[model samples]
Target: MGIKVNLDEMLHQRRMTLTELSGRVGISLTNLSILKNGRSKGIRFSTLSSICSELDCEPGDILARDHSSLEGED
Candidate 1:
């Protein structure tokens, strides 16, 4: 399974820019960009909470699990 971040989609849906979200979420643009691009390995709970608060979205809306795995069945 893999975890996916749909930050870009959410940002578009909310009509907000990455720079604006970075400022509002108290996170650096580079770090936010990394997270947005799915290059981030992990995110802190506090940071996630701040992002959710600013975007008015839940964790489920921002993240999803993909069950397609190569190690499972043949």
Candidate 2:
């Protein structure tokens, strides 16, 4: 299953930047970059909750199922 991180879209919609979010979430910019770039293997619930709270969204708004990856399954 492909888990897609839509941070860019959410940030755009929220009129926010990574650096701004990092401060508001109390997370480092580098670590946020890792998650924003989809390079992180996983994220803790507490972290996720913090992000969602700051973004004013639900977890589903950040992470989504990349159904495109399952297109060729038989």
Q: Estimate each model's TM-score.
A: 0.88, 0.89
lDDT for each of the candidates?
Answer: 0.88, 0.93
Model 2 CA RMSD to the hidden true structure, in angstroms = 3.0
| Local accuracy of candidate 1 as per-residue lDDT tens digits, 1-74 | 66779999999999999999999988999999999887888999999889999889998889897576554532
Error of 2 at 70 (Å): 5.9
Cand. 2 TM to true fold: 0.89
- Residue 19 of model 1 has an lDDT of 98
Candidate 2 lDDT over 1-74, as tens digits, reads: 57889998999999999999999999999999999998888999999999999999999999998777776543
Clashing pairs in 2: none
Q: CA lDDT of 47 in candidate 2?
A: 98
Total clashes in model 2, counting residue pairs 3 or more apart in sequence or in different chains: 0
